[model samples]
Structures are given as structure tokens and as C-alpha cells.
Target: MIGSGPALAADGASTETAPAEDVTIVVTGEKQDRTLQQTPSSVAVATGRTIVDQNLISVYDVLDRMANVVVNGNRTSFSIRGIDASNVLGGGDGALASVYLDGAVLPKAALVTGPLDLTDIAQVEVFRGPQSTVQGRNALAGAVIIRTADPSYDWSGRARLLLADKTGERRASAAIGGPIVDGQIAFRLAGEIARSDGLVRNVNAGGDADRRKSETLRGKLLFTPAAVPGLRVVATYMHDRHRRGGLYVELQPPYAPEDRVSTSDLIDVTEVKSDIATLDIGYDLGSGLTLKAVGNYSHIRSHYAYDPDHSADPGQIAVIDDPNKTYQQELRLNVDWNWLQGLIGAYYLRDDNRGYFFGATQNLSLRRLGVDQSLLKLGLPQATVDTVINLYGSGVPIVNSLDQPRVTQNHAAFADFTVPITTRLRLRAGLRYDRESQRRGIDQRVAIDKPLPDPAAYPGLGPIIGQINGLLQATAAAATSYQPERTVRYHAWLPKIGLSYDVMRDMTLSLTARRGYRAGGSGLNQQRGQVFVFNPEFTWNYELALRSAWFDRRLTFNANLYRIDWKDQQVSVQLTPGSAFDKQVINAGRSRLYGLEAEFSARPTATISLGWGAGYSRTKFTDFDVGIGQVLQSAAGNEFPNAPRWTLFGSVTWQHPSGLFANINARYRSAFYQSALVQTHRDIRPLTLANAKLGWQGEHLGAFLIVSNIFNVEKPVTSALDPDGRLRGMVSEPRVMGLSFEGRF
Candidate 1:
């Protein structure tokens, strides 16, 4: 198990088969099935029973309780150890980490907008280090694998209803499975619907600013032809829709943490819809050999609209629409033998993303371009300079329309093997050759929204007016529509080697080294109206791990220590200071990161369980120089944004013989910078959150009371200075109490 914690049975009931220490956990993240203790990879596993017991409503909720993992406040990105998912190389076309549902890889936009609600799930596994050899591209940092429940021979069903206070949260979910043919076919179906008024109160709009709603449905079919005893087939389909309000709120005077209020006149909204389908087939050939094939397809669409100014006036609104589609196929053969065990696979993928944007918003970068200083240098009158400054200092509004489309195709062949060198020692090695090609195109248009001032109104100002008008027109022209298409190809060889030794009957030690990679891509410089390409980045990771069992198999302890060296990092560079539109991705940064993670779980008694996890990471740029404002600066010693140095979590659970149970859990994160700029004011403070559940469980029915954020700790998950010189950001959700009822039959 990921936490090695006390896990309930699949039916949400206490395990009576054996002691906690004797429980066996099978992990499949590595494209093979192995007991947790036998797997040398650094991974965490959470079962469906754990999700229900802890009230983990989504994947993000589960990530919060894991050590050395952080999800950004916006939910658009996450980080494993000190490596960010999206911003590791500043900004890029590919993510460092990938999320998978069933056997389907989720699209990038789906990571931000789609519903990741946890319903009828079988398991969730998080691989903490580089998975390049087995996962190929976009596995520079890690991967998240989720498996939903499948049909079984016996009929089974489960249902749950939930309600919460203040936020007006409500949820209903159900899952059922049964055998269609006594021994050949089976089917499963699951669905969920959820709604919440959200915590951020839109005071100006007279409603909740971050209201949310989601719907999810899934179905699975399993077939085992009686004639083909060794053959098995599984097909799955899922649909999800999610809608939510804005994630940010204005931070002004008289700010009340408990109130969670926002003053924006328009409540920003986003909606995402997704459809996914997967088919998996396996045939067991005799003699410990198996052949497997998988195919997946997914489509996701997202729409977003927001008030860019964060003010009460009807100023400017920004809107975006993104539609993405993906298809993947994989074929692998597994071998299990006394001397060696391994798998060889070939994979292919195609992804298409189409995005469109239309908006009218203020352009702060243009306002900061030293126009007034240039005018003064030209010997313009002080009064005239002041007038021009007043006219444009607040920023000039501009209308922008953009259409960006990207298509990518990947092909790879890989193999992984484990060999027994001795009775107590094992060697593992893996290699992959990957080739990827991407085609991206952009079409954008920009125009000033405010008309030029008339020179007739002021005497003796015609020359200055003409000069200002000319400058404004030049700026607009520089930002005008630019249509460009580019195709880039990247190829890489990824390899991994590791060794594991059984030091004792109940103890194991392992060491691993792996190379991680991300494919290179092209980006557009809107300000320069040009296209730029960046090189691929790589990382070498060294990890040491220990796994142990103690106290007659009642206690478990695991730890991992790792160091990562990164080179040719694709960092975002602003060619012109104070101009956001002049930025492009470049391979101009290097960094180093080291971290330690430890977790322990103990079942002191049959009814009592305890688990604790802690992580510490030190991250710094080793070689980095970039433009900041009007000057070049070095970030060699600065820590990565959102990478907290310390993170801790703990949980305790008690189940009484009288059908009553209780669970309490808490998580803490140390203060850390929220921006790569590393300013003192941009530091987000430390935060601690706790949750509790009290419930009664019977054979077929259960009820519980859940209290989240029990102490109402309201802290900013993200923070930045607004254009108006005010501190504005998104705050964590406040305390919420809820009741839930569940039934199993």
C-alpha cells in the first residue's frame, strides 16, 4: 500500500482474514502485478475503501494527504517532490507528470477542467520519481494511475448520499455489478452527481463566486468466452461534466478570512465535458506467460469566461474554449520465470488540441514599457508628459482573438526486467526508445480598444499627439494577427537500473537510477509575431529506499531518499523586460533537488490503527539567469515556487465492536514561495488542516458525520499582487460539516 496503513476490505468492512501485517497489496502502476514489498519503485497506493473511510471526494483530496506531493490552489497543476507538473521549465507544451484514468491518458486540459471525482474506484497509485522507461514521454517527474472497479461473478451494489452545511454541498452516488452469464460475462455501472454553493461569496454579485456542479457516469463489460478458457476481455466507457465558478477573490481592506468574500461584478465560470472509452484484452498462454493489448480514446471540451479586471464596473471579460482528443494503443507480453521476470511492450498515441480565445482586457506590460521616460528624453514638456502618463499609465484596453491548434503523435518500444542474482538479491533494468512529432499553429489578432485622443482639443499639442498616436499604432501593429505553423520532432533513449536486497525476512533495501525525459516543442511569441522552438529536457534521479515490517507483522515502515539533477531545462524567457508577450520557452536553466520521505503504520490492536507520513525537500536552481523587469538577474539559489520544504500528515482510526467507528486525520505544509520571482511578499504562509469522521457501520447500511477543516484555517493557497497594488489570491476552503449515508447489498 502507498501509506502501508490499515486498509479495510473491498466491501468497506473490517478484514478478518489475517493480521494487518499479513495483508498483501498488488501494485500495477509498472505495467505488471507485484506485491507492494516486491516492487522497488517509490509509489503510494490508496484503495477504494480508504477513499470512502476518509471522505476523499476527489483525486486532489487524496494528493493532499500524501507525503512529498503538492497540488496548486488552482487545481490546474501539481508537483511531486520538488518538481512541478506544468511550470518546472517555467511554461511548456508538455506536463512533467501524467494522470491516467483506467487505461486512458487524460488530456492536459482535462487535468484542469474535467471532474476527477472519486466514485466506484478500485485503486489509485502515485509513482513519485521518474517513470520514463515504462511510461515514456511526459514522465519526467511521475505519474498517477487510477483503476475503477470491474464486474464480478457475484451480484453487488453500493450507494451513498451526502449533505454539507454553509456551502450547501450535496452528492449522490451509486454503483452496481452482476454476472450476465453464470461463467462467461459480467457488467458494472456507476454514476455520481454533486453540487455545492462553494465557499467564496460574491458580495457584489449577490451569490457564491465559486459554485460548482459535477456529473459522472461509467460502465464496464467483462467477457470470458467459455470456448477460449485462456482469453479475457474488458471494455469500459465513462462520461464526466464539471462546472465551477472562479478560483480567485479580491483581497482588500476589511478582509475577513471566515467570510471568504469576493467583490467581482461578474462571477467567472468554467465548464468541462469529457468522454472516454477503453478496451483491454489478455490471454494467458501456459507456463507463466501472458499477452495483453489495450486501446483507449478520449475527448474533452472546456469553456471558460472570467472578469479580467476584478472590479465592479462592466470593464472587460475574457473567454476561452478548448477541445482536445486523444487515442492510444499498447501491446505487451509478460514473462514470469524462476530465473527472471519482465515485460516487453510497444505503444502508440495521437493527441489533437484546438483552442480559441476572445477577450478585451487591460495590457499592463504595454503600460510599463517606459513610454513616458522616452517622451521626456525627447524634450517634451513636463505637462505634456504628465498628460500622456495619465492617459495610459493605468493600461490601455485591447481586443484580442486567438486560435491555436496542436497535434502530436508518439511511438515507442520498451522493455523492463528483474533478474534474481541470489536468493536475497535482485537486479532490475529497463530501457525505452521514444519518438514524438508535434505540429502546432497559431492565429492571433490584436487591436487597441480605446480611440486616440483628438489633438484639436488642445492647442500646440498636435506634434505630441501625433507622436503618441504613432507609438500606440506601432504597438498594436506589433501585436497584430500572426499566423504560423511549425512541426518539431524529438527522439530519446530512456533507461533505468536498480537493485534490491532482502536484508532480513521482513526487511528490504533498494537503490535505483533512472533517466527522465520530456519531448521538445514550439511556442509563439505574440509580441514578436514569431515562432520559437525549445529543446528537450532531461533529469537523472538516484534513489535509495527501505521497507520493513515489525512487531509480529503489525507495524510497517518505509522510507525513500532521492536526489535529482536536471539540465537543459526549458525555462520561459522574456526577451524584453516588462513585456509578458515577449516571452518564449528556452533551454537555459539547470537545477538540483533532494528529498526524504518516510511513512509508518501500526495496528496496535485489532480495532485501532495509526499512520503517519513526513517529507522534507531542498530545491534550488544551480544555474539560471533571466530577465526580471529591466535588468538581468540570477535565480541560482532560489527555491522553486510552491515547493514546500516540509510536509506532514497523520491519521488514526478506531472501530468498535458495537458497530461504531471514528477517524481523524491532519495535514501540514510549511511556508513556501508562491512565485518563481521569490519576493518576500509573495511567500505563502504555512497551513494546517484537520478532518474527522464519526460513523456507524452495519452489514448493509452506514451513516457518518464528517467535519472538514475543523478549525476553519483559512490561508491563501495562491497569492499575487493585483494591478491595483492590492494583495489578491485564492484562499483555502473554510470549515464544512456534513452528513453521509451509505448502503451496500
Candidate 2:
């Protein structure tokens, strides 16, 4: 199991994940599944203690602050080693990142964004590189495994309250947990609430409440019957809701004045609710082995909304509503011998996502709006703007809404076995057979509102209708059937065999080769892009790793070299051609990626510990020729979109024998592009920031303070498409601070 301590003891519970439990030599990032000093893979683990100490609530906070993971929007669209995409519409399809809360997967991508309320968390494991052989999803890049502590039969609980003021914002949060029953049941509940005043001010729409207010609640329950000593059942539920104002983008050109972007009037409300219940039955076979089984069920639902430009324009209105639901059932059986262990399992995943979109544009004529310069500027307006909008209708309440349905049912059986031919040599192999039924379609209907009749005399003109009209109808249907279904059976027998050799007492080296995959889906929302289709792809990775400790166990090191061959890499691109159509997800031709990753831990004194993480990646599309080239070097290759080339995440922490505590943490990320196909933004660069904590922990009480962005770096977070094309970025987090107190009864 993953745990915690001083130097090596950091297992599953401890959040510090730093040096482990006081020189315990912790290790969970590798192929052999041993301590950091014993495992031959470069992994990063964060403990619950570290999370609380650092005041991290959501996955975004932890990834951006504690680990070296980078994401777009400063907090979302996660990416490890340049494997992430921009989430322009809030709903991004390139979410290759897999989230495993405990052992069950987080179905929807939005839930992975923010406000996780890091409470009762055991450990967070960040696996680097492809790991299709041992994980649930055949992740394209890697996976993040979050393991929470099990409910203890013993009664134990902790609670905390926090208050903070930064710049012009204030935040508050509180939580509590304890035992539900003597020795058979236990529970934990945690919640957080925070509100802030935004940094940007829109004089056009003034409001100090332009900031966001968020709330979250999480509960954990565990039961172990005395009559059934080995059987334990656990359940978890989480709900998070956030409403933000002033979160608007700008729009320029013929539609509005220069630098005129939407602001505060644009209201955004998003919510997430997740329910999970699991039962584990373990039995002792009475031999050198035991039997363990895990049965899990989880459900998550979320809704996101935003008003692009909050005004009475009647035009320029945009609304989107999405409700995603998922049901997953998985079972696993594990056997452990003296020198060998393995697990066999099967999973059933059902997901359905339904959404509605409404977008309206300026009421002005396309020629006047300058939508197509060739059509209007130089004399082509009729063929350009006039024709498109004329087909859809005009003026207020334009019927430009679409219904999108994405549903999938997939079933697969997979198993991975680890056998030790000797104490130092082992073999790992896995296979999976997947069958999926997928359906996705975009059904659109443009409302045609006939010219309003003369109301003066129309008092007799029957409801906005007039004239030659015994021939006119109240409603006209401009709709079509958009139904598409495809059944697929994916067969992949990913066989992985690695070699491990122990050089010294706590030193090891291993090499592994495995294959990863990306699921196939509908082509695109634009029916025009079906010219030449592409197939779902696969990526094969080869890795060599080393793990060791030296200098009287005071220093630890982990390093790996890997190269990936991505065939049929899927990429998303906008089809605007000469105009701006935003951007979307699509499968690219092919690609290649190679990199070096490493992590280190050192303790020169008894009270001070130092930790470091670094990575270098080169991901490119080797084969993509649609007009770009059969050998396309997209903006993605010139620069990895949303993924930094080099990142460093580390901490210098000091502990006093009298219980005083202090630590400084920082992250540095190299610059990368925001899109895969555009040279539109080449001036973009990377960013570096730091956070510090000062506190005291007593046997019964604790007090602490946190300061974020100590350097107050004016970080320029580049965007794929700013509301105004001239402004390349938006205002980023300037600085933040908070104070908190905790007590144990």
C-alpha cells in the first residue's frame, strides 16, 4: 500500500510525499511497485499531510503547486510532458488525463478541474509516460492515481477553519470527520467556501462581486463487520458548486470598438456532484497467498453554463447546457505469493453526454460586419456573409441552437501478472479485449422569424402576422435527421515484460516496453470535414529507469529515459481556413515523442529536507498532410501546446523539534504554444512562481499561514484565442494568502 513518514515512510496517507516517514525511503512510481528508493521509475506522490499543510483544495491546486504537472487556464486541462490541449468551450475532448479517486475512475473531465477539498486523502501518484499494461484506461500520456485512506475502526477525526485576505479578496473554509461506529464503521466529512474580488475591472459593467464563490462537500464511510473480519465496504460522495461573474471575453473589429471585450455581465455557473460506493471482500487461503476482490460503482453528474456577453444587445448571446452521466462497474481479484503477485479484472463503462448550444451574432449585415473581406471588402460579400446568415435567419432570437448527444457503452476484460523468475528478475504482461457501441450527432434547427407585421393596424393582424398571408404558417420546421451509430471491437493484447536488477541493498534498474491507445469516436460537429477520414491511433513507449539511495541513506534519486512512437495520433483543429472558427478535437496522422524524467530527495540536516522534480519532452506530429503537409510541423511541434518543455517542482521544508514548521515550494514551467496548428501566437512564454508556509503543530492544536506567489510574478498566461485578437493574454493570479487553525479532540 502507498503510505507516509520522514525520509522514506511517505506511503498512501501522508500528503508531504516528500521524503517519506522520516527517512523511510518511500517509493511508488515504477514498474516493480516498490519504494521510491526501490522503484525504478520517476514518480511523484503527494500525501494528505502535505495537502493540508499547503492548503490545496482541488486537483488543479495540487498539480500546479506541488507536482510538476502543468495545465491551461493556470488550473485546468491538465498536461504532463506536453500532452494537453486548450479547453476553449469548457468541454474539451483532449482530456487524456485519467483521474482515479481511490481505485475508481472519475468519469467526467470537468470534475477533475477544481475544488477537490483535499481531505482524508492518502496519497496522489503521478505516473509518467504510457502505462496501458497496468492501468484502467490506456492513457496516451500517463495517469494520476489518488488513493484515500480507508476508514479506521478506531475513532479518530480532525477539523479546521481558515480565513485569508489577498490583494482585494477573502477566503474561508471548514471541515470535520470522525467515527460512525465503534470498530465497524468510520466516517469523514470536509467542506470549503471562498469568495474573492477579481483583479480586472470593466467600467462598462461595474461590480465588486465579479469574482467567484465556491463550495464543496465530501464524505467518506467505511465498514468492516466483526463477523466478517476480512470484508470491508467503503463509500464516498462529493458535491461542488461555483458561480462566477465578470468571466467574459472581448470581441473587436466591425462588431465593436477596439479592445472592447465582454466582461462582468457574463455570468458563469458550474456544479458537480459525484457518488461512489465500493465493497471489498478479502479471504485468507491459508497458504503463502491470499485472495482479494474489489467491487466498485460510481456516478457523477455536472452542468456548466456561461453568458458570453451579458448585455441587452438581443444579439451576441451564447448559452450552453451540458449534463453528463456515467455508470461504471469493475471487479478485480488479486493473489499474492512470497515473490510474485498479480491481478485479474473486468470493467463495464457506460457514459452519456447531452448538450444544447445557442449562439447569436450581431444584427448588422455580414458585409457591414466585415466577416468576409473578400466578399465585402473587395466585393464578395453576397457569397460570403450574406449567404450564410441568410440561410439561418436574422435579427434577435436567431435560431442557432444545436443539440449534441454523445453516448457510449464499453466492456472489457483485462489482466496483468507479475511473476518472479528469481528474487531480482520479474515478468509483467497484460491483455484486454474491448467492445464499444458509440453514437454522436449534432442536430440543428435554425428558426426563421418572418418580418414583423405593422402593429399599429396589426391589432387586427393576429399576433405579428400580416398581409398576403392566408398562405403563411405560425411555425416552419427547418430541421434534418442527424443520427450516426458505429459499433467497434478493439482488440489489443499489450504484452509488457521488463527486467529488474538490484545493484545494491536499496538500488534497482528496470527497462520496459508497452503499447498505449486512444479510443475512436465521431468525426466532428462540422459535417464538411469528412473528406478523408482517419482512424484511431496507438502509441508505443520504450523506457529505461533507475532508482537508488546513497550517502548513508541521506540522498535519493530516480531517473528514466523514454521514447514514444505515436501512430495515428489524434489532433483537434479549427476548420476556419481563412477565418476564425475557434478550435476542436480531431485525429492527426502520426507523431513521435522522446523524453527524460527524474526526481530527487536529499536531507543534509535532521530538520531540513529538500525535494526536486524535472522533465524534458519533445513531442511532434511526424505524419499529417492535409494541405499542411504529409509531414506536418504544426504549431504543436514548434511548441508543445499547453505543455511546458521543462518544469521544476520542489520544496525546502524545516521542522523544529518543538513542533514549529516552515516550508517553501515553487514551480517553473517552460513556454509552449496554445494550439496545435496555429503560428498565431509565437510570442508566448513559460512561467515560474513560489508559495510558502509557516505554522506550528501541537499534539492537540495547530495554527498556520500560507502565502502564494511570493514573488508576485506578473505571469502572462497565453491563450488560444483571446476575446480581442490584439490582447494576447488575460490577468493572472497576482498573489494570495490565508490563515487557518485546527484542533483534535
Candidate 3:
């Protein structure tokens, strides 16, 4: 949590110089608006001012520097501590960690891409533990809450432009907000456009890979009529369009050097368009009571295509077209009194998602390559090779297609209360009941355009021709009208209990225990045509925390120690090796995780501020076994995937009275495995990054320059290994320097 104080120039980490006795940081997700010091949990905050100064483009940028948080591969996967929001079995109805935008819960697909621009953002809050009681389902791990800037009565607006080297990236944004009726209503409008040529090169296509362009538009209105006292309504609408080049998978061979600038015959591509609308209403019912309601609707359409072979030859290619729709609503009431405060709420969500995939047969046709090097190596004459090629027409390219449609519904009711047990002690408790139902359907088909000739017509080459044609027919035959649909129902009760005590004049101690749950789902085992249903999983989390301020409110320090025991973990099992559709989801045994985190900010002098934070986590699988009849493999003692052993981050800022400031930040993460197999070769290497910024500000204008990745480290962010030992994955960003200017009126 950010301390209550006058902080240095905002640039990522919190760099506070002197704590202000009157200053307070408010947290809204805790049922009642309370100061960070009053909340008995771990949370991280990044303000709009910090976002602009740090040049943060998305939520991923802000979460990367946070303690005990991991943002993996293409910013699509996120985890807290060692637990990923996306369950291992991939059978959950929703994400374990929920992302809320302006009180509206966003779907998992929206979370994977990015959030709206920060031009209209007020603050970003990250809760670092299970918040099932108040947050409801899918919050077993944690949650990210974002609030947009409110409309102000004063007419004001700002515009900014940015240019960067390395990727030839450019961005422009503008925003304006004012009053529609001096004291009754207000409105805000904002938009941004960003484009990047990208750093990775595709020599084969004579173009850059991963190039991207995006545009966004948003509008908000706040209405507070004088005729209806204590009543307010807020409405928001947003549209976003994004397009990107293919993934740059740099293949590594024993004979070649590392290639960050290369790819094969196919250039992958993707495009997405989304529309979102939300409304929030609140009314003060008087007598320390309030009523609130929130509703949201979203629609998204996306397309993706990529080469599966990753080579110069057109061996295999795949593409997907997906369209999704989601609707959510929540209603709640809060009561606050001298001795007691609490909240009760109910939530509803419905999601409709559909996808279509198309691909060719497994291996490229060899029937057309009768005269290749293999035949030449056999000392066959060129004439004979040509004759053989003429005997067999080009091999058929079987086209296969699959269509999947799914729907899920979630309903939950929850309540939380806090009571003062003594002058210096308090007790808190919460309960939640959730029910989920889901159904999915799949349809597949295969086709080919070629057929074999009669054996009597080509007796001499009948044997070879028969073999090739038979394989093609078999491939087409494998596609069947198999429709597997099942409806799964789940219900669970989640609870939380905690204690808080004010032990000293400026210090507090707290202890909390919470239970988390993720609902189960049904799927078909494609290998054996068998249907299966995996059971839900649960986790118990315990934490002890200390928060304090020192030196006449000039410094602050905080620490947290936590442990979690997970039971009935969902695990994915493969029926056979190298079979894409042959997998099943099942419930495995237990796992354990424990960690410690410490954070501090101090001002040794009035001109300089320093802040540092570190965290260490240990995770292990206590029991795990797999196989049909006997245990073929066990991962009982393996570390969790993508979970680093420890993480360290710090920031320093220097400011001058003349409005000049400079800041620097550094982060380090230890090595960790990328998969549950625990193979040494699959471990991701450790990394350390450094960033710096120099800027100056006036009353209504500001300018700055930033240099990121000073060392120009070309590290691999994620990796994929082929059966033949070829390794390739997405690489980290190279060095980049940017200059920006901003003006307000």
C-alpha cells in the first residue's frame, strides 16, 4: 500500500520523502472507504500522476515492477505469489484473479490484451490475496481494480505527444473534461492512438514482425441532480481496435547463432475490435446507509493466424476466428455505525464465447517431391525422377475445421462485517455463497479434393499410388460428427476472519485467515471419446502483518508473512505423447506455498527520496501422481511454473525546488522453471532491468525523456522447444529512448 505522505516525482515505485499527518490514501474495495493503514491486507497502488511520469502504456507495465507479481508471455498470463489466475486444468468458469474497470468486471480475454488508456485513469489498485468474501467468484488468488478520473466542474483538458527510438514507436493522446450544468452534471472525453514498427525482424518476409497499431475512444458522464439530493449516476462507453504482426519465433539450431531477426514462410497476424458499456448508480439512503448498483456489457471479435512449422517451407498453418459477448451486474448496500460497519451484495454474470479453427493435415505432401535430394542421393537419373513425379499427382492438402461454442453463468451473494471488540482491538468476518453453470459444444469436419485411380488403369504404379491415396482417405475419415455437450453445476461457501489491533501510537498489527474456491467444469477426452468432470479446488490462506510510521511521520515501513495450503488442485493429463487433442482434466493432490514481503520508504534529506521492496516465496507440490494403471511420473517436489524464488525492486528520486526532477528504478528476479516437469533445460534465466527518467514541469506544461533497458539485454521472455531440440520463444524488448511533451489548459 502507498503511504500517506508527500511523495517524490511519480515514476513507477513509491518514493516518499516526508509523511504528512493529514494525508491519507483511501482504499475503496474494503466495503467501506478507509485509509490504507486501516485495511488489514496487502495492496499496491499506482496513481495517474505516476503513470504519466513513468510513461506506462498498459496495466502490464504497472504490474511488472510490483512485488510478488509475475506477468508472463505476451502479457497474457499473470500470477500472484506462485498461483496463476488461470487454473492449471483450464476448467474454471472464470479467472482466479479478477480485473475490475470502473466497478465493472472484465472478462479473461479483455484482461489478456490490455486495459483502456490511462489518460482518463485515476488510480490502479492491486489486492494481493484472496478476496472471495466481498469480491465473489474467481477472486481466489487476488484482484486488480481500476478507477477512471471523474468529471470535474472546472473546464480543463490536456494533450501529449511521444516519440521513441529502437522500434520507431509514436503515440498521441488528448483529453477534456468540464461541466454540462455548473453544479448538477459533468462529462469527460478522451482518446489515444499508438503505433510501433516493432524491433524483431523477419528476414524471410522482408518486414518487421510483431508490429502493432491501436486506437481507443472513451466517453463518461456524471449526473447529480439538485432535485434529488444524495443521488448520483455515472455512465461510460468505450471502443478499441488493435492489430499486430506475427509472433517472432527465433529458431535455435546447433549450427547457427542466436537469431532475434528471423522467421519462416508464414508471417502470423492478429486483429481485434471491442465495444464496452457500463453504468453505475449510487444513492445515500441517510442514517449512515447507502445503495449502489453496477451493470456492464461487452462485445469482442478477433482473428489470429500463424505458421505451425516455423520454417521456410509451407508445412503447416492454422487460424482462428473468435467472437464473444459478456454481461454482468451487481447490487449492494452498505451500513456504517460507530460500533459496526458492513456490506451485503449480489452478483450476476453471463458469457457467450464461440471459436472456429482451421488447419491442414499433419505433414506436408511428399508426393510432389519425387525428384528431391533423397532420390538424388539414391543415384537415380533425372529422367527417372521426372517420370516418377508425373506418375503421382501433387499430394492432397487435407483441410480440417473445428467449431466450438460455450456459455457460462455465475451467481453469487456475499456479506462482510467489522465490529469493535475493544478500544484497541477489532474483529472482522465475511461469508459468500456462489453457484456456477456451464455448457460447451464442439463440431469438426475434414475434407480433401483428390482421389486415387483404379488399380487396373495403372498396374505398374498401383502399389505406391494406393498407399498415398489411402493415407489421405484415412485422414478425412478421422473427422466425425462427434458432439459432446455437458452442463456442470457447482456451489461453494467461502469465508474470511481477521483481527486488527492498534498496539502503539502510530503502529498496527493484524492477522487474517481466508478460504478461496474455483468452480469445476466438464470436457471431452478426445483420445478415447470419454466425457469427464473435474471437481472444484480450494485454498486456505493465513497472514500476519505489521504497519508503522516513524521519525515524526517522516518514514514508513510495512511487512507481511503469509502461507497457503491448496487442496484438490486441477491438473491436465495427456493420454498419449505428441497428440494435440488427447488430453484430460483431473483433480490432483495438494500443494503448499509460503512467503514474506517487506517494504519501506524514507527521506534522509528533503531533496531526495528512497523506496525499496523485496519478497521471497517457496512453493512445492506435496503430492502428485499420473498414469493409466501405474504411476508413470510424479511431480511431488517440483516448484510451481513461472514462480521465481525471490524478487527485489527499488527506486530513487531527486527533486529541485525549481520543478526539475530525475528518477531511476531497478528490478531483479531469480530464475524459475517454465513448466511443471522441472527439467533443468526448461528453466528461465534470471534477469535484472534498469530504467531512468529526466523531466521538468511548469504550471500547465511538462517535458521528459526516458531511457529503458539501459543494458540492451535481449533476454527471452518465454520459450518453446520442438521435438527436434529447436528452441524458440518471444524475446524481451530491446533498449529504447523516448521524448514526450504535455500541455494542459
> Of the candidates shown, which would achieve the greatest TM-score relative to the real structure?
1
Tens-place lDDT digits, model 2, residues 398-441: 34456667677767777766677777777766666655566666
| Candidate 3 lDDT, 1-745, residue by residue in tens | 3221243221112222223333345677665777666777787766665565566678877677677877876677688886777764344446789888877677676654544456556667778878887887788888888777667677878788989998788989888888999888998898889999987677776788778888988898889999999998889998888777765566465322235655566677777788889998889999989998989998877777776655554555678777778899989898898898888899998987855344444333343222233355567677755554455443345566677678889899998888899988989889999988888776667676445455457766565456546644654565444677667789999999999899997799999999988888766554344556788889999999888888875677888899989888777766544344456777775789999777776666776667677878888888775544223256688788888878787777676768697778777888878877645654678888888878986667878898888787767777776422367777777779998887777
Runs in model 1 lying further than 4 Å from the true structure: 1-22, 355-365, 368-387, 455-468, 625-632
Per-model TM against the reference: 0.95, 0.82, 0.88
What's each prediction's clash count? 2, 55, 1
Which candidate's lDDT is highest? Answer: 1
Clashing pairs in 3: 246-268
Between 1 and 2, whose lDDT is larger?
1
Best-to-worst TM-score order: 1, 3, 2
Look at candidate 1 and give me any clashing residue pairs.
Answer: 2-44, 2-45
**Which stretch of 10 consecutive residues in model 3 shows the poorest summed lDDT?**
9-18
Using TM-score as the measure, name the better of candidate 2 and candidate 3.
Answer: 3
Cα lDDT of model 1 by residue, 435-454, tens digit: 99998888877788877667
For candidate 2, the per-residue lDDT at 607 reads 78
Question: How much is the lDDT of residue 67 in candidate 3?
Answer: 78
Q: What are the lDDT figures for the candidates, one per model? A: 0.81, 0.56, 0.72
